[model samples]
Target: MPPVKIVTDSTADLPEELYQRFGISRVPLKVLIESQIYRDGIDITPDEFYTQLRQGKLASTSQPAPGEFASMFEELTKDGSSALCLTLSSQFSGTCQSARLAANMIKEKARVDVIDTRSATWGVGLMAIAACRALSQGKNHDEVKELVDSLILKMRISFLVDSLDYLERGGRIGKAQAFLGSLLSVKPLLSVKDGIVCPTQKVRGKNKGLERLVEIVEQEVGEAPIICAILAGADPEARDILHQKAKERLNCQEIWLGDVGPVIGSHVGPGACGIIYYSL
Candidate 1:
């Protein structure tokens, strides 16, 4: 049997180089800005998307259609290689549903297994990377799928957004909705819990928020070796600082830096940074 091919949505927010390195395929989500539609990470870049947001332009996003996923899967599996598709949290978007529909469409012609990772951004990206690593170890398609499913349960994702306005506008505020309209200076620390964004803490300033993020991770994982991914939304300084702090404090076995793409950035806004990891 051919090796399993790894696939994910653009919301995974993995760096381009990693995709090329792992031979992973990604389906693009739609981003609407200033009356024009762009594919996240394909038609528009994170830098360009944030530039428009800073200019006071509103943005919205949509999940790719089932046909998009079907076309990609059929092409990848033409040679009889089974495909494993990892998607963003079902609670956050309908991307997972779309992938599932496509999997059914091609069930007879090819083997496609779609998994709702119950995570987003680098959270999904980390799971995809783990799948690739398992495949490299000569694990079969079913074995790799089981491994990713376990990682989904162990995944811990938390982020600090500069403001809750964007999330509120996008209707993804979740339990963090309470943080809205409080104080302009308050930064909300949120986490992806059970496939949805949930409030964790509210800090008065960005500096304290960053510190609190590290504290939360340390409290959860301690010195256990972990695989981590640091995410930034047009804020490299914050990303670098968080990366340094994580390296200094945690027993990280593997770590990578990724950017928040247009789709996720539309909701999180700029100056957002976070960490996603699972202990090995």
Candidate 2:
């Protein structure tokens, strides 16, 4: 069998260079700014998205249509290779549902497996990275699927948003709903729990929120050798510091730094940063 190809959505925030180097398939999501629609990571970059947001344009995102994934599956397996598509949480977006729908729509249905990772951003991307590693090790489709399945549960995502406006509008606030009743000036620390985004804590300002975020990550990984990634909306300066502190504090084996895609950035807005990691 040819190597099992890895697939993911734009919200995974996996670096583009890795996509080309590893032959990973990324299906872009839609980001709507005002009345304009842009493909995440393609038409609009993180810096561009944040610039527009700061300029007073509100944005929204949509999952890829089933036809998009169907086309991707056909292209990935055209040369006798199978595909393993790890997608964003179904609870957050319908991207996983679209992937599953596309899998059945394909002619070679058994040549692919669509998994709902129940994580977003690098949390979902980390599973794809693990699948790529397994594929490179000569593992077959089923073996790679098993590896990804285990990695999903071990993964964790924790973030601090500069504002709650986006989360409130998206209705993904979940347990974070408590933050809404408070003063609008408070920054929120959030986490993806049981497939839903929830609030973890609150602080007065940006620096304090970032400090709490690093502390949350250190507590979650706790000396484990998990591979880690830091994703920023438009706040690389703060994210870089968090990355260095995390590396020094958690003793992570490897770390990846990338921007949050436009779709996610739309909901989180600018000044959002987070960490996702797993021990696979």
Candidate 3:
């Protein structure tokens, strides 16, 4: 049997080091600023993206074209290797659709499977890692895919953002007036359910919002050993707060501190802090 290869897009928001360590291949999506497009983690690094954001440059992102995914799919399957292509949530981006289209175009003998994780950032990253672990255990392609799909169902992701300004800028918000009620120094806790983001609760201040995030995760997931936590942000202080709090609550075993990649950070904005973890 050919070696099983795992693939994902840059939006998985996994750290560069972890991606390398796991030998996972990532196809990047592009972030456009004033008509200039930069590939996530390629032309633009996290620090550079944040710097531009700080300098009043609003960045917009685009999904990877089908041709890009087609090329990657062709290359990986060329070596008689089977591939598992995981993508960001279908609702959040077109990346998943592009990958699926590319997979359908494959004519090679090697099999290619595409998975829409229905989650983002580390929520997707954790699923990719789980698939890799199963593959390493000598599991076959279908077996690995099945395991990952099931895991994705039980996965839970909730986070707190410092402000709703980014969402408004990204055109993701349907009505600015809806958030107007909580605009006065309020922080919002958001959760991703079935591939769409929805507001969970609003707190009066940042501290209360942080407390609410931890409380929700613990209560919802309960005590699940096979859980993973990730702190993502462009702001050092915000990211540090998440990292420190996660360690204190989750006890370090289920924790991963990852830089929010450009694709994700573009939507959440700088100084935005959040966590994505699985439930048991």
Candidate 4:
């Protein structure tokens, strides 16, 4: 059989270097801004997406077409190798379900297993990195699947959004809608629980919200050695603080810092940053 292939959606938020270095194939999700369509990370970037959003444009996102994933699996598995499709939380998007349907459409020919990461943004990115690390070290699909499953249990993700308008527009407000009554000033802290977005805390100021985010990290991760990813939505100050504090406080084995692309940004809006760490 050919070497096992790793696959994930662009919502993972991993940098291009890692994708190239690890042989990971990423399928782009569709992003719509002002009725113009762009591939999540391809035609549009986080900077451009946010810039457009701030300019009074309405933004929305769509799941990848089933062909978007099936064609890639067909290409990657033509040599008889299997693939594992890791996706963002199903609650966040239909991408995971789309991937599963894609797998079904190709099952008579190639082996492709679709898994919901039950997380998003840096959380999904961290999972992809761990899978890449395993695959690079000669792990087979089954072996890496076990590794990823274990990593998921240890995964912890949380973030602070600058405002709730994006979430509201995206119809993912959940319990975060309670914060909107704060007159658009409450900085909301959110996390994935049971694979759905839920409000965690609401702070009155940006700095205070970020501090609470880091504190929540410290409490959850506590002294374990972890591989961490810092997610930013075009916010340098928040990213720098989260990165520095993660390094300072956590026993870190590896750290990844990148902007949360359109998938997450379309919901969180700009000026947001947070952490995703899996204890090794």
Give the best candidate by TM-score. 1
Q: What is candidate 1's CA lDDT for residue 223?
A: 90
Instruction: State the TM-score for model 4.
Output: 0.96
Q: Of the pair 2 and 3, which is ahead by lDDT?
A: 2
Q: What does the lDDT come to for candidate 3?
A: 0.79
Over 1-280, each residue of candidate 4 has an lDDT whose tens digit, in order, gives: 3677889999988778878887889999888887799988889878888898788788888999899999999999999989998999898889999999999999999889998988887787778878888887888889999988887788887888888778888988777676776646778888777577788988888888878877887787788788888888988888898888878887888888889898789888887788888777
Scored by Cα lDDT, where does model 4 land? 0.84
Residues 1-280, model 1: lDDT tens digits: 6878999999999878999998999999999997999988888889999999999999999999999999999999998899999999999899999999999999999999999999999888988988998999899999999999999999999899999888999999898877777688888999999998899989998889888999999999889999998889989989998999999999999889889889999999998999999999
TM-score of 2: 0.95
Q: Quote each prediction's TM-score.
A: 0.98, 0.95, 0.93, 0.96
In angstroms, the error of model 3 at 153 is 1.0
Clashing pairs in 2: none
Instruction: Using lDDT as the measure, name the better of candidate 1 and candidate 3.
Output: 1
Candidate achieving higher TM-score, 1 or 2: 1
Encode model 2's per-residue lDDT on 30-89: one tens digit a residue: 989999999987898788889999999888889999999999999888888888899988
The digit string of per-residue lDDT tens for model 3 on 1-280 reads 8888899998887777888888888899999987799989778888888888889988899999888988987887787898999999898888999998888888445578889998888888888888888988899999999998997888887777777788777765433326535766888778878887778877888777777777777776555554666565666676677667766776335677777778888877776677777655
For model 1, the stretches where C-alpha displacement exceeds 4 angstroms are none
How big is the positional error of residue 64 in model 2, measured in Å on the Cα after superposition? 1.2
- CA error at residue 59 for candidate 3, angstroms: 0.8
- Model 4 misses residue 271 by how many Å? 1.9
